[model samples]
Target chain A: MERTYVITGAASGIGKATKELLEARGARVIGADIAGSDVNVDLTTLQGRQTLVSEVERLSDGRIDAVLAVAGLSSPTVATAAVNYFGAVATLEGLRPLLAKSDSPRAVAVTSMASLMPHDDALLDAFLDGNEEAALARAAELAAGSPEQGNLIYGSSKQALSRWVRRQAPTADWAGANIPVNAVAPGVVLTPMTASLTGTEEARTQLAGMVPMPLNGFFGPESVAQLLAWLSSEENGHLCGQVIFIDGGSDAVIRGDSTW
Target chain B: MERTYVITGAASGIGKATKELLEARGARVIGADIAGSDVNVDLTTLQGRQTLVSEVERLSDGRIDAVLAVAGLSSPTVATAAVNYFGAVATLEGLRPLLAKSDSPRAVAVTSMASLMPHDDALLDAFLDGNEEAALARAAELAAGSPEQGNLIYGSSKQALSRWVRRQAPTADWAGANIPVNAVAPGVVLTPMTASLTGTEEARTQLAGMVPMPLNGFFGPESVAQLLAWLSSEENGHLCGQVIFIDGGSDAVIRGDSTW
Candidate 1:
């Protein structure tokens, strides 16, 4: 039986590539994006994600099998949380009903290597004290300051998200529910996002020099798409809640080169 | 050349015990808390922490060598962000100026094993996409209407903080800057915060059986504090932005016992 898949951010980058790959493998693919007509929706807003989820659910014909949430924005410091954090959550929550209905469901979200920034105890203590509203309120305070505040807000968000995924493994039986929730933490992928950064000679050179990759090259969206295909497949049941790295060992490369 | 240290949440539990241990070792210790004259301050509030930082700076007599941020709240699932995340950040940020004045400086924060809980990719991607505020805002949304919502908020905050510490390692130079930042991630310690969980007969029995201890049954704040002391010592310059687990082999035990 052919499976049904709902892929977000599918107009371009990893989502576009994954949509093609899944379709080639005989999967019924429903592609959604902020910029495309496959299913016009904004992932960042609650209403936008609801529309996307509703479309996916309607298109699935009652047989949705997986969700690949590849929709996200990348920035050096700011504007990341709006689309990456809230948009992704809204996507997941919106798709919950469809996921619960499926026997072998799976979900994959995109994370980054930048999630490894450092902070002091006092900062962390305050963050852990609030709920969504309080958390948002605090986030406003963090966002209100200049980006030069000497803290990587984007990295902190990813770290928190990665840890949350790790914790969710035992309770929410993604496997039992026939759902696998996994993430891909890519490092230096050459997407439209990276194109902008790489356009600058200084940024490109600096980033390339940091990686010990065979060609000193970055991974393309298709590489991450390939990983997504495997993770979303039924054969990959054992790898639930895993944060698969698709950045050609950039993590190791950076670690080896950087001295504390 | 005796050094004076300030410990927050120092009136009870790990904070109090750690204070006793440090003072016993002849380190000049000034106890601070939400309600104490030496330095009564609530780390969760920005103003409260600012006041505490000013007092600590003034009282140190020009020698506030290190701070052990043992002060925190551990409700099963309440505003961990306020007390744990933001409070820790504010406290450290406040202390940074004081630490800069000292010749050799160190700081350590206490964390929990709960932060190890697994999370999914979608969540991580959401967190990685935005600024800190955006990610935290999305985290609040993810945690809004679930029984495990508290866990989501608290664990996410700690994980965020932990990740921040790791990233800071490469850039933060304790030897060069004259200050060190590290953390202690203890597993199942006998602190007042954990007393409710471990105090009950059923809970105690279950926890005792679960302890795969190599040393004693269940390590307390004292054992963890001893390690904290070492990490905070000037001799331990190399160790920075690390979370050392003092669980009586619980991690090893879990590994050995797991069949899945």
Candidate 2:
């Protein structure tokens, strides 16, 4: 059977790599992005979510084997909260019915190592509470403050999204229906999203001090894509709710046995 | 001043190993368990939780450096739910005040690789909702059923505990007060707890079939002990809400990239 997949943020970066990998292996992927994809729709809005559901359903003939909610923002704005947390959640929830028709339905999303960073408690709470309006308002309030405050918007969005994935995986809609829903927490990848931040040696060092990946300093989109492809595969069945870190032992080196 | 530590389940297994390792390094340890330890309190009860807090405070003179909540049960009984989830939580939460007295405070607990297995949704919800009576009742109901049904109690307890550890890691008390709290999920370990299950070659093979640790196969309490000691160390500052798996390559092999 030609497995059908719907991938958000398929225009570039990790999403692009994942789309390429799955397509190369003879899978049918319906790419969705703000621009240059089969379904061009902004995922940060309610109308965008509705459009995505109808379009993906129409394109795939009302069936999808998996969903990869890879689209996200790394900026320090309310827009980051809108796209990263709210947008990703809406993408998964809205498209879940289309995915339910498959025997081996899987879902995976992208979160960041920044999830571990200190964040704004109110904004994180609002996202978890499912109040998009309040979440964006909180993000806006933080944005008008210092740079560290701005960073919290990005950090909290990623953190809340990761927590959401973990909590939702075993819920009735996903795990109860035998669909394995999970998320990937990448340390720092060399993609269009983070090129300028890690382009120079000085920038890389500074980022490394914060990220501190011991295995390989900075990897490309392909490594994360490889992992993402495997997650969305039918073979992966055991992992119910996990945020696997793919940063060359950065998790081991920095976190140590703290998590264990 | 020497660091003072409180370790539950110090009578045997991973806690005993961790206690020995930490003490050998010149730290002072106040061991606790059901029997054969400094404070022999049954942590499955509220009175036991209160006893542990008061006694540990007396032993350490109202001050402690770290808390290792290693007491747990793997049986298919309500006692397992009481001890594994509620007990470990009380061990840390009860001793947290004493830990805050130290210049370097840390907390860690032990979860299991079985946490990834299919679980009872109602029981899991009960545990998460902080309803001990309900959780135990649900566990008792499942324990009277088939072997697989009985297994869900242990799995759900561990799973719930792991989630609780993650959620609490960033909250007002632990992370807010600068106490680095985390958990470690181990695969099968050759200890008093699992000696009968993984004793013979046949039994080990059966266990391996379920666990699927591709790296070094089954591990020992010493390996987990080393990690627990590090998590309690002052050096671990970056990690929050992480459950590091010390299960050879079981997590990696089985889960693949589902979480990444």
Candidate 3:
């Protein structure tokens, strides 16, 4: 039987790569994004999220084999927190019923190595608390203030999102219901998101210094997409709530053995 | 010259214990809480935090030697996130200027072993995002919905606060300006906060089973107070952004050497 999967942020970057890979495997893909996708949804607002869910339900005939929440923002802004944290969560939770209809349901979300970076406590708290408007509002204020502030919001949003995945995975609706939920925390993947930074030697050198990728240079989107695809597969039954960092040893270097 | 210190959540629990210990050492102490203290302030609100700061500044005569943000909530509530994460943060950040005036300054916030427990992602993000209203609102909704939901909110709040302390400890205003900021995460301690849970034998047995305390049973507030005193001492200059878990080896047991 061909599986049906919903891949958000499917227009480009990791989402696009994952969508193509899954489609090649003979799966029916329902791609959702801001543009150039089978399902167009903003994912940054409550209405957008509701639309995405309704559309996915309509397209899949109320049955979804898997969901890959790969849509995200690399820059700091209120919208970053809204789309990356809330948007990803809304996609996963809102479509959970559709996923439950499948024999083997799997959900994968894209976090980042940035989750380990310093974060704004306020922004983190807002996201954790589930106040989308307030979290976005705070993120907007910080983005307008300083670059570091923006970075903090982005990092915290990812961290909180990863934590959410872990917390929800063990619950009845997920692991109990046989739905494997997990997140992929990639290091510096070379995608359109990082084009500006990796476009020049000066920027690349600076970025390289910031993240210690002992294994090799930055990763391509395909490498991360492959891991994500596997995680969203039927074989990924045993893994639940794990945030697998494919960051070329950056997480190991930074966190060491602290959170292991 | 007598050193002056400010302690929030001083009315009861860890804050009270710490206040008693500090006064015994001959430090002039200013206690703050909702009632029965030198300053009456509700830490769950911005205005309350401002009042606490202004009052501390006024009472300390413009110089504060140390600060202990020990007030916290063990139960799950929106107020838990507000008081645990925001209250502690506001107490520390709001009083930094006064701490900067001292020759040697130290700040300590009380996190909890519950931080390692499963948490709500939305609550954690809201706290980190620094949106108190949203975090509180979400927390309220969760508390009203489920008992476990409340526990999650409480745990995630402390976790986010601990993360914040670690992130802020090395900044210019902290390590650079000679003020050390850190947090102490205690496991199960016998205090007013845990009275209901630890008071009964059945509750004690259930609690013991939940947390693995390899060293012993529950800890007294004084054991935590001792660690807090050391962290807030003038002799302690090098420690920064560390959330030292003084929880009878529970942290070590749960996390193992993975995050060492």
Q: Output the number of the lDDT-best candidate.
A: 2
Per-candidate Cα lDDT values, in order, are 0.62, 0.83, 0.80
What TM-score number comes out for model 1? 0.48
The per-residue C-alpha lDDT of model 3 at residue A132 equals 77
lDDT of 3 by residue, B94-171 (tens): 999999999878899888878899988888888878888888888988899878877788888888888787666655
**Can you list each candidate's DockQ?**
0.01, 0.04, 0.02
User: Candidate 3 chain A, which ten residues in sequence have the lowest lDDT sum?
Assistant: A251-260
User: Which has the greatest DockQ?
Assistant: 2
Each candidate's chain A: what TM-score? 0.83, 0.98, 0.98
Q: Give the TM-score of candidate 3.
A: 0.52
Ranking by TM-score: 2, 3, 1
Candidate 2 residue B130 C-alpha distance from true site, Å: 36
What is candidate 3's local distance difference test score? 0.80
Off by over 4 Å in 3: B1-260
Q: Comparing to the true complex, what docking class would candidate 3 get?
A: incorrect
Could you estimate the TM-score for every candidate? 0.48, 0.56, 0.52
| Native contact fraction (fnat) of model 1 | 0.00
Off by over 4 Å in 2: B1-260
